[model samples]
Target: MSPAEQAGTQPELTYEQARDELLTVVQRLESGGVPLDESLRLWERGEELAAACQRWLDGARARVEAARRARTPDEAD
Candidate 1:
């Protein structure tokens, strides 16, 4: 399957899953065994995975912040 199709199939991967895949991509690129063209493709996929992971983390942070605010006593009380 195409990289984009594979990425879409894994919609909503947890932060850890996305991170692990990104790390693997980095390792592959660093190994230098791949052709330049394929390496570029991997780099692109890595970028997409990194963005997905960041989005997951951002959402989690927002939720945590919301929860914390909900529990805090009102200063105006």
Candidate 2:
């Protein structure tokens, strides 16, 4: 299944939603109680979530840069 489908019963999440869940994943990993396999799984998920967050941030940055460029010509006058 796609990442949007989630691995199991979990629902699809937006960038912000994935980020929130990633914080939980980080907290669990830091607490150090889960099994090895589970820890690895969380780590993998965290990587994906981090990538997703980066994509969102990159897209936002691109939009802002475009907006600035669009305004630059006007500002020059």
Best candidate, lDDT: 1
Task: Write one digit per residue (lDDT tens) for candidate 2, span 1-77.
Answer: 43444345355467789899999999999999899999999999999788767766776788899999987877556
| Superposed Cα deviation of residue 18, candidate 1 (Å) | 0.7
TM-score (C-alpha, index-matched) for candidate 2: 0.78
- Measured with C-alpha atoms, the lDDT of residue 30 in candidate 2 is 99
The candidate 2 region of ten consecutive residues with least summed lDDT is 1-10
Listed in order, each prediction's TM-score against the native is 0.80, 0.78
- Model 2: colliding residue pairs: none
Alpha-carbon local distance difference test for all models? 0.81, 0.80
